[model samples]
Structure formats: structure tokens, C-alpha cells
Target: MSRQAIGKANCFHDKGHHADCTLSSYPYMAAFGIIQIILSQIPNFHKLSFLSIMAAVMSFTYATIGIGLAMATVAGGKVGKTNISGTVVEVDVTATQKIWRSFQAVGDIAFAYAYATVLIEIQDTLKSSPAENKSMKRASLLGVSTTTFFYILCGCFGYAAFGNKAPGDFLTDFGFYEPFWLIDFANACIAFHLIGAYQVFAQPIFQFVEKRCNRNWPDNKFITSEYSVNVPFLGKFNISIFRLVWRTAYVVITTVVAMIFPFFNAILGLIGAASFWPLTVYFPVEMNIAQTKVKKYSPRWIGLKVLCWVCLIVSLLAAAGSIAGLISSVKTYKPFRTIHE
Candidate 1:
């Protein structure tokens, strides 16, 4: 393969750690965050039932996506020319890249939605006033700026405080040890936010799987005849034993490590930073500029390009700083020594 392809393959394979982290914990974070927020508002209600139901629904939804993707890959068969290791690496990288890209897309969507909603509210509040437009404009800008700062601050603070030792879900970890009221609140928030992230990442995979199953399996008749399975449960479930096993393994391993360390935030931070840069800063703008060029329209593409470059620079710096922090943390470790009589 070409050098670019090779580089991509290597990057993907090396990103196995990141893929594991994103697929397993990223969804959980948002779910837990939202669940906490809800519980905080409805403290007296039996919120655990709501939280459990939300988490179960979200987890199953994402898990179905994971299974479907695995099935599609299995059905499509391998690209024969690629090395097995390269392919494995590429898969790992793609999975993590998708997670990060989905995250940024969701962030942008959230900003737009919030801005529109807030602006509408402001317009109603200040209707017909001379300062209405100006006030709304200022508030919108302030809100966007402040929200961005808050996101970066929380991410950075979690990274800094935990270093490479950051937890898989910092907010959830807080819930575990914090006061009862706070823990309950945190769980509620996390559960809800997690469902959003899960849906964003999972829905596409579900659609892809559905498409592939229709194309390849076509009424599930082939599997029944070929595999000699007559049971309705097997067809209804629409998942293979292998896929289930693999996903279970993924969840089991990730949960075990996350529970054991619980404070390995620095590594998580570095991985997240690295993944975020390309997904958030590089890809979208590039795609936009490419599409604009294809349509023979130039709408301040240069400005967008510049913004992308700036984001790239910032992301690189953040990634470097995170790595340096991680290394420093490792260096600071000292082993206990015994005193002899």
C-alpha cells in the first residue's frame, strides 16, 4: 500500500487503547451526566428506576450497533490485499476516529440548538425593545464563549488533576465518592447525557447493519438453511455468538480496568486530546472546503481554512502538553523502600 495508507494503518492500530476507551466509557459519561442533572431537579422522586431504565436502553442500543458493525464486517469479508495486522489496526483506528468525530459533531449540534433556543427566548423577553437585538447578540456570544471555556476547563482540570491517571468517567467517579445527594444527582445527569452520545454513535451503525443484513441475509433465510438453525430466537435476535462474545469481551476488559484503576485520567486525557484534534479540528473544515470547491463556490473558505489551521495548532499544543504531563507523572513515581534493623 501507499505510505499514506501505511501511516493511517499504523495510527489506527496504535489507537486500540483509544477505541476501547471511547466505545465503552464515552457513552456512559454523557448518560451519567444527564441523569445527575435530572435527579438533582427531582430529588424526592424514586429516580434510580428512571436512571436504570435509561442506562439499560442506551447500553443495549449502543451494543446493538457494535454487534451490527461486527456482523457487517464479517459478512463483507476481508480486503485481501491488506495485511491482517494492518486491517486490525485500521479497524481500531476507524472505531476510535468515529467516536471522536461523533463527539465533535454532537458538540456543534448542541451549540447550534442551544443558541437558537436561547436566542428565541431572549427575543421574546426583549420584544420591541431598542436593545433587544443587541442584548440577544451579546448574550449569544457570551454563552458560546462561556460554554466553550467551561468544556475546556472541565476537560483540562480533569486531565491536570488526574494527569494520565484520569478516570474513564471523571464525573461518575465523583459520584462514587461524593456525598449522597451529590452522587444521586451525578448519576442522573450522567445517565441522560450518555444516551445522547450513544445514540449519535450507535444509530449510524444500526442503519448500516440493517442495510447489510437486508442485502446479504435477505429475510434471514440463508442463515437458517446454512447454519441449520430453526429456532425463532436466533432469527429474532439477529446476532451471532461470535459478535456477542467479542463485544462482551470488550465491555468486560474495559470495565475491569476502569474499576481497578478508577483514576487513570491522564492517559484517557491524552488519548482524548489526540483523537479530538483530527476529528473536531481537521476533518469537518476540510470536508466543507472540499465540497465548496467542487460546487465552484467560494464563501470565505479561506477564513474557514485559517480557523482549521488555528485549531490544528492548538490541538497539537494541547496533545503535546498532555503527553509531557503524562511522562512527568510517570517519572515522579517512587517505589517504597524497606528499612532494615
Candidate 2:
């Protein structure tokens, strides 16, 4: 998405807004993947606090820029057509398509609040003085609330400005054409943020896989041994042959997969839908009920279960919708090509 943002911004800057700016996204994705491959070599999660902090700053920067740009568009009296029925069956969109898109929106929203995946990692870092869970809860609440509010502003105001024609990414996807430098900087921030964010998520998966391999092959030097390399003005760095091979292959496969799909909204929606119910709703709710020893079939327990079931149904529907979208995208998808959102 950041790659597309930068390319689109450059395209708009060079050519007029209405000019043809279509280009392949393969190189950009590959470049981003290579960066991740290097970052993936970081030896410890604890070493990533600096990256996480920088990512937070980048996120704030881009989000604020997006909101400001959206408001500016509206203020300049360039609001796109809006209707009571959001995104009506027009502009080549059908009733069925609209419904599916709406479902995709649900998943997209869920993906926006995807904090659960990183929550435990963060909690692991908290001090023991204040119970970690309590501190995590308060931190989670504040973080969620703040980010949710920003997202709402971006969604509502951006929709108000662009109506049903709004792009998936405000900074990149035809939402704003002028102020090219701001758009470029915002997109750069996105790319920077993603650099750290990808490591944050991928490190855990790497650790899991490496740990499993070490356990399975306890005496295998290829998997368990680490070689140290000294650097000028820097401390010695440790590298493992298995980690290098496994991690590189993992990144390469994922990068190729991304290029194959290249439908950001659809892919994100599908992931969000698949995980929302399981990770965000089901597990947490079940854990809370179990911890509290809530009696089965009691009013509170029943209500909670009912809500959980409702979320499950919603998640299933959202997943189906996203699948439909992916199918639709597949029909027109060209490998290594960017699918316009």
C-alpha cells in the first residue's frame, strides 16, 4: 500500500490527475520484502522497542496527515456525491456487489482494531510492580480508544469528502492529488511504520518456528548453533544457518504471495474476518468467563454467549463476503500487478 501511495503520488505529480498512471507494483513489493528480510534477523524482541516507538510516531504522522487532507478536501468544496444509502448500485457496482463490499467493510474495520495480536507481546514487557494484566488492560483501553477515535474521523470525514468513491487509502488512492509532497511524506511514513510493524508481527512467528525446530532437533548444530560476527563500531552479531535459511524462505514466500494477490482491501478483509471472531472475540470472552467462573446458562453467561455467537455469525458472513470479493478480484487480477482499490 505504501509503495502504491508513493507511486501514485509521483504519477499525479508528473502527469495531470486525469492522466493514465497505471504501473506494476511488483518491484515495490519485492523491495519492501527485502527490507523485511534484513530486519527479520534481529536477535531479540526486546531489542525492538525502539522500532516500535518509531513505528508509533510514523503511524501518528500519516494518520494525522490523512485526516487533515480529507478535511481539506471537504473544506475546499470538493466533496464527492453522497447518498443516504451509502455506495448505491452504480458506477458498475451491483446490489450484490454493494452487499459484499459492505461486508468487506466490516472486516476492514475489524482489522483496524487488530491489537490483540500484539497485546501479549506488549504485556510481557511491562514491569511486575503494577500487575501486568491490569497495566495492560488500562494501556489497551487507552490505545484502542485513541486509535478508534482517529479511525472514525478518517472514515467518517473521508467518506463525507469522497462519498462512495473514496479510495481504500486516502493518502494514496486518488483521494488527494495536490499537495504532492505532503502525500509523499505521508506515504513514506506509512512505509516506515510498516517496516517496524512487520517486524513486530513477524518476529513472534519467527521465534515460534525457530523454537519448534530447536526443540525437535536439540543437538543439530545447523539449527541450534549461532555464529558470532564482529563489526566495526558495533558489537558482535549472532547468526544461525537454520534461521537464515528458514526466515529468508518464509519472507520470500510471503512476498510472492503478496504479489500474487495484490488486493489489499480484500486480503486484509479476509484476514481480519478469519481472525476477528477467534482471536478478538471468542478466546478473550471464553477466557474471561472461565476465569470468573460464570455459571453456564445464567443470565449474564447466556447474554455473553449470545453476543459471542452473534459475533461469530457476523464474522462468518464477513468472511464469505471477503471471499466473494477475492473471487471477483481474481477474475481480473494480473499477477505482479496492483489491483486498484
Candidate 3:
């Protein structure tokens, strides 16, 4: 989704006018998705170590550039004057509207923090150790702390710089000035970062399906072994026909959905509203409460339980808002409209 968004932004940046890039993205998405599907065939998670590191470096690079740009604006007196910041907390709005907007923002934040859903799969890639959980805890604490600091800085500074004029993607909103090359480089980093990130997340789905297929099929015997094909140059590089078909289908489906619905923020809102409370908030709290087995009437238990319910209720309401937002977006939606459109 972001790749397509960036592609569209590049259209504006290069041509100084909006051009629908969705049709062009058809081939690009197909090619990239296929690359990801093929890369998923590598069973050893360690093989992705370098790519993951590169992705992290690129992510940090772009984030630092973003922060520096915002800071530059502040220092140069280019910061806009806008009263929109923190309006969600203003008393001028109706209570219901305030709650709805607040929850909507919560949904976005939850979506951004949605890595918890896949953190266990990532942890499984670690070597087995009695202290594995402790290691993961320390790693999570450090990672979260660092990322939170950057997120806060970027958000506060970007809002201060652009205020109501801020684009959904700050990098794409920059003018072609002295830092034009830097802006382009930052965008390139995002694209390359996503290429690796996609596989890391998509591999879990591939593994799940492949495992189930292996369990049910019980061998390459589901089809005649004759169904396989070998590439001549890559000696013994045999590809199972069934495996090829199944994984390719998964890639095609995902790519199609991404192309058809390129609303990145709306999709994130939906994902967060749908899964964040259950996976991130409710389950962990319940697990802690169950493990501790505090008295049901005690303050700790009661407080935790209440928090769980609040998270659940808030998630549901946020989901409703997300659905509403999606429907409204569709009313103005074009299949591949540029930002100017």
C-alpha cells in the first residue's frame, strides 16, 4: 500500500502534476509480490538477517531525516501557524464526537504498534534458550523505548512544522529545493525497507499454509512425483507443482487486494480496531491476571479486569468508526487517484 502511495507521490514530484500510477503498479506489485513469495521458500530465518538489518538502517535513516527536516523548519521560522493541534481534546466539540475522534486516533496508534501480533513468530526465529523469554523482554523494552522516542519526536516536530498543512506522508510533501536529493533518498529507503519488511511478515502466512499442506498431503505423493519440474541450469533445483501453485495463489490474492484498496491509513485503522485490543491489550492483561491469580475482589484484579473491558469496548467503538471512515472514503474514492486528485 505504501509503495503504491510512494509511486503516486513520485508521479507528482517528477511531473509536477497528478498521474494515476495504479495501472503501472499492476506489474510492479506482481513482480515484487512474486519475489517475496519465492524468498519465503528459504526456511532458515537467519538468511534474512542481513536484509532485516538493512531495513532497520533504512527505517532509522528516513526517520532521522524526517526529524531533522522538522527541526530545520522550526529553526528557520517556517513553521506554520495552526490551532489544530490537540483539538481532539478541546471542549468545543460534542462529547460523542470527541470520544469518537479520540478512539479513532487510538486505532491508528494501535495499528502502528500492531507488531505484537507477530512478535512471537519473530521470537521463534531466535535460538532456543532457557533465558529466551528474558532476552525477548529486554529486546522488546529497548526496541519499544527507542522507537517510541523517535515516534514522539517526529509527530511533535512534524505537527509543529506543518500543522494543518501536513500531508499524510511528510517526505512526499517537500519541495524540490536543496534537500530534494535527500528527500528522494529517504523515499527510496522506505521502498527498499518495505521490500524486506514484506517478506518478514508474509513468511509467517506462507509457513502456516505450507505446514498445513504438508500435514494433509503427507508427502509429495498428493500428486504424482511426475508433477514436479526441475530447472536445468540449477541442478537438482526441483520445484513441487503443488507448492508453486499454492504459494503463488497467496501472493496473487494479497497483491490484488493491495492494488484494489490502496487506502493505507483506513486499512491500518481497520486492522487495529479489529485485532489490537484482543492481541495487544486484553490477552496480555488476562494472562497476567490469571498467572498471578489475585483475589477477584482485590484492587489489582478488579483494576486489570476493568482495564480489559475498557480496552474491549474502546476497540469495538473504534472498529465502528473505522468502518464508517472506510465507507466515507469509498464515496470519494478513485481506483488510482493521485494526491492532487
Candidate 4:
């Protein structure tokens, strides 16, 4: 029953349906599923052939790509729109409204590492700085650099461990055999992560709905009633109509894709990585260029431009490589087709 519910949730959340909401939650869920699959096959550890490991590695690479693309997209958007407001309130509200979109953009860069490196570090550093904090720039540079290193490290580890035989998705690879305690812990982590992702995407939508409701309702009852109606299955589950509806949609979409896609992990990873380049590498440089344009050009400025160009080239190459892999994977899709005749 729980599994079925999860499947339903994922179906409604996948791309082409509620893409914005899915963008935030899908990566984490996909990762969780992959891990589950790996652990399941632990008893068959000796039977874990080289081919399986290689497939797993490929999938992981794709996942990293997905994250990278997301990060790049977010950073790029921020750079492009830096001039919108000068006041703190305006900035806060604007940033909040677009937080999911930004995160989605950030996901394009390097998923876990990019978020940790660029978004988390840069945001924290900037927020901590005084108006005259000259060190903020240096700090951000160091932070992003560190992030890149970690991403490379993880990718290398995954490749070395699995090579070309890695599983297409983590869960299917492992057979979902982790101990109950560990499984419980993992499930908890997945649930919270999903919630966080949902909040990131749904906050803006919720706010918009709230405002519209307020105008139309003039009283709280109408808003409450409408909110109930908006959430479909969740409303039936006796959960908080808002949260239930939001999360249910996410879970359903992910589940559906997990079941349908032959190499779900690789596909998700590819999407993520492609998104990251623009968000992390390309956007930040562009933003720096825009921010520094008013000041006199210096060696640092020239260096930044050169760096931007390099990042752009690298990002393009990475994206191209990912697409090529996807195409190759598609060409060899004999394993996943059903034999109905």
C-alpha cells in the first residue's frame, strides 16, 4: 500500500506534468532509490558482475550532471537579474519567490556539490558580510573552487567503483536489501528531503494561491475549502491538504518514471548535469562580469572573463558528452522492452 502510494505520488510529479516541483525532489528520491537497490544485492555481493558496476557508475555520472545543470541555471538567472532591486525586503521577497527556480537552476550544475558549494556557501557568505566586506568576493571564489573539487572526487569514486557496469538506477542495482534500521533511516531522510524540495518549489505556488484565495474568499473558510479541493488524493488521505497534495504529486511522478525508464538514474543524471553547466559555471562568471562592469577593468576582471569562457566551453562539452551517452543508451534499449505477444 505504501509503495503504491509512493508510485502514485511519483507519477504526478515527473517532468511534463509538474516539472518545477519535480525538479527539486526527483534527484534526491532517485538517489535514495538507487542506494536502496544497491544494498538489496549485498547478499549477492560475489555475484555482482563487472557489467552491473559499470552501469551503476554511468548512472551516477548522469546524476552528477543533472545536479550541475540545475546549479548553473539558478546562478545564471541570478546573474541576469541582479539589478532588479536594491533594498533588503525587495531582495528577500524576490529571492524567496524564485528560490525553487533558482534551486532548479543550481541543480543543473552539480546537484549535491554545487548546492553545497555555490548556493549554500555563497549565499551564507554574502549574507554574513558587512556592506564593506571586501573579503566576500575571495570567500565565494574559494567556496566554489572547493565545491568543484568535491564534485570531481565523488564522480571519480563512483566511476572507479562501478566503471561501465554500474546499474541504471541505484535501487534496481542493489535489490533494496539494506537492514531495516538503515532502511528506516534512509526513508526518513528521503521523506524530509522530499519535503524540503517540495517547500522550495511549492512555497511560491502556495503564496500565489493564498493571495488569490484571500481576494476571492474575503474570509478564511473559502480559502480552506478551496485548498482542500486543490489537493486530490492527499485530501482523501486525511493529511494536511496542502502538504499532502504537494508531496503526493512529487512522489507519484518519480515512481512512474522509476518504473518506466530502463536507465532511470542515467536519464535523471543527464538532465541534472546538463542543467548545472549553465547555472554554476557559466552564470556565475556572467554575473561577476555584469557586477564588475561599472568599475574600471583590471587584471582580475580580464581573468574572470577568460574563466567564464573556459567554463562555457567545458559546460558545453559536458552537455554534449551526456547527450551522446543518452543516445547510445537509447540505441541499446533491448533489455527494457516488454514481450506482450
Best by lDDT: 2
Residue 145, candidate 4: alpha-carbon lDDT: 74
Best by TM-score: 2
TM-score of 4: 0.41
> Candidate 1 clash total?
35
Comparing candidate 2 with candidate 3, which one achieves the higher lDDT? 2
Candidate 2 matches the true fold with a TM-score of 0.95
198-283 per-residue lDDT for model 4 (tens digits): 33333334445545765876655523533223345433222234334433454556555654554533444455666556666667
> How do these models rank on lDDT, best leading?
2, 3, 4, 1
Provide backbone clash counts, one per model. 35, 0, 0, 79
Instruction: Put down candidate 1 lDDT per residue, 1-341, tens digits, no spaces.
Output: 01122222233355641332222333343343344332332211122345445754644443333233333333555212333232233553465443443343333333222223123323654656667868777866885675565555554444444433344444333201223333344444444545443333333333344456657765564332222334465342233433333334444554444333332444445545565546655665677677757333344766776777876665555455455544654565432211111
**3 or 4: which has the higher TM-score?**
3
lDDT of 3 by residue, 1-341 (tens): 33544655565556664444433455666677777678655544556787789888988998998889889988888876557544434444555555555566677777767676567777887777857778789988998898899989988898788765555568754522336557767777887888887776666666677677777777567432433345578444545566567667887788778767766666677788888888888888888878878888899888888988988887887777677667767888776543333
Model 3 stretches astray by more than 4 angstroms = 1-28, 44-46, 84-102, 173-178, 219-240, 336-340
Quality of model 3 by C-alpha lDDT = 0.70
Worst 10 residues of 2 by lDDT: 332-341
Candidate number with the higher TM-score (2 or 4) = 2
